[model samples]
Target: MARPDKVAAVDEIAEKFRGSSASVVTEYRGLTMSQLTTLRRSLGEGASYRIAKNTLVKRAAENAGLDGLEELLVGPTAITFITGEPVDAAKALRDFAKANQALVIKGGFMDGRTLTVAEVNQLADLESREVLLSKLAGAMKGTMAKAAGLFAAPASQVARLAQALADKRAEEGGAAPAGADADATDATEAPASADASEAPASAES
Candidate 1:
């Protein structure tokens, strides 16, 4: 690369580091060209991997206000800058490392904080940003369904009460007496005349 082109590339890297959400340092010491290509394809659009000189990287890190990252830039190091979710890039790197052992993860930076190797691995295990959002949407939908069910319960109870009252009235058949007292002892008894007589009992009962 020409001197002017190299200088421009360094400036571009610095600008990217300044704006990116996260970045991971790795040692691609023995990885073949095809292996690096596979790694790049695996990362897709959310992350980018590139090999740059350590001195340029140090300058970029310093320009990006991440001076602490200088110590990690050593020995055929390449960086994967995660412009989107940090976890996605971490997961990609972990998977790539599993297949190509030469692409080793050294450390990373997330949300402006330095991350250890263990922390980076933990980040790799997290769900993707889209997956987390989908779960949140499902939960909200379930909550709305439950609320609708709760709101309908009172109407159901009212209908049951009306049905019960209607059933009781149907069973009664309007049989309530009008001022008739069965226990009245002062009621006068009627007597029959001679012409009015009881007919012979049926079957001589």
Candidate 2:
């Protein structure tokens, strides 16, 4: 290709690398065109599979301030630029590679960190974003429920105690202390009667 075309291609690749959340480099050595198309389709809208010249990709990587991909740039390199969820894209590449053994996972990069082939496989093993978020939501809901029960426990115990006291009072017939009050009045009257009798006896003496 001409110099200007090469420069443009490099610029385009660099921009893609810069925009992507992560990228996976693969060697599509014996894959057919139809198979490649199928791989691209399987990747869905989250990722794109493109075949580019190693020299151009290397220059692009450098331009994008990404390093350590130089080793992976060797061979028939096809890069998967993941702009969306990395787990989904990783899963796609992994599943595709499983079906088509011709597609070999070489290495990848995310957040300025390089990943080995094994690490890429590990990434694919993770659950999707939606699944993880759902799990988190379920856990948070359970925690809130437990907290509500905890906060209401003291109030519930107090109510139970009050009810128990009321029940005991009702079982004992709930009567007033009329007998005790009458006895107290009688005791006061007896003291006054004794005082009156003493006064009469003194007057007679």
Candidate 3:
């Protein structure tokens, strides 16, 4: 590449680094085109692979405020994958490495933290972002449902109590209650009047 071209290439890589969540340095020394293609496909969506000159990548990393990444830009290096979620790219690369012997994962960074090979593997084992969101949504829905049930319990009890008192009054053959029974009957009857106001009105044609 020409001097100006090299500079532009370096600048372009730097721009990518600035925006990337995490970048994995891998040795694609012996990977065939088919193998690379398979690797790309296997990484799921939003993962990418590209060959980059180490020196340029190093400069980009430095410009992007990413230090300690130069160590990973070693010999026979060709691919730099980026993602919006730092762990996603790491996870994909780790899984790919597990299946392909030729593809070696040197190391990577996650949100400014340098990740070891093992760390990357652990990240891959984690549930995807979508799955985590769904779990949170389900939990929230369950909590809301429980709250609704709790809120309606007292109203339900009151309705049943009103029914029971009416049954008791009928069973007594319309005989008025005396003493404490009178007070209970009055209390029960008071709620029945209020119940008419509280009940939902049926639509009339």
Candidate 4:
């Protein structure tokens, strides 16, 4: 490559390193052009797998202030730059490697930390961002529903108690006037009987 082209290539790789959320270095030794295309398609739009010269990639990594990738950049290096969810990208790479044994997962860097092959596999095993978010949303909705029920419970109980009191009052009101009239009639008869008894006493005197 020409000097300017080499410089541009290094700059592009460095930009990828800086812009990506995570990056996985791999050795695509025996993969054919068709297989590489299939691998790219499998990775989806969230990641870009590029075959670059190791020297340029190393220079780019160093330029981007990313360390610990120099040792991993040996022998037909292809780097997968993940701009979206790392887990999804890791999963794609892992599954593709499983199918094509020629694709070797060297190592990766994510969140300012270097990842071994085991770590990358573990990352692939994790749930995707969307799935995790959906689960969290479901949990939040359930919690909100419970809170709403709790808040409405006291009001529901109060309404029931009020209705019971109203029913009791209605039942007692129907009989209250009849009982009052009966007591009044008994009071009047007692006064009249006392007067009659006093009249007999006066006659005897």
TM-score, ranked from best to worst: 4, 2, 1, 3
**Candidate 2 TM-score to native:** 0.77
Task: Please estimate how well model 4 matches the true structure, expressed as its whole-model Cα lDDT.
Answer: 0.96
| lDDT scores in order | 0.84, 0.94, 0.78, 0.96
Which residue segments of model 3 deviate by more than 4 Å? 161-205
lDDT of 2 by residue, 30-135 (tens): 9999999999999899899989999999999999999899999888999999999999999999999999999999999999988899999999999999999999
Error (Å) of candidate 3 at residue 69 is 0.6
Give me the displacement of residue 51 in model 3, in angstroms. 0.9
lDDT of 4 at 148: 99
Range of the 10 consecutive residues with the lowest summed lDDT in candidate 2: 171-180
Residue pairs in clash, model 4: none
The TM-scores, one per candidate, come to 0.74, 0.77, 0.73, 0.85
Worst 10 residues of 1 by lDDT: 186-195
Q: Which candidate should be chosen as best, given lDDT against the real structure?
A: 4
* Per-residue accuracy of model 4 over 7-101 as CA lDDT, tens digit each: 99999999999999999999999999999999999999999999999999989999999989999989999999999899999999999999999
For candidate 3, write residues 1-205 as lDDT tens digits: 4599888887888787776677777899888999999888876666678788888888877887888887788887765557656556667677677778889988877678777777777777888788899999999999999999998999899999999998997978656545668898889999899978667654331
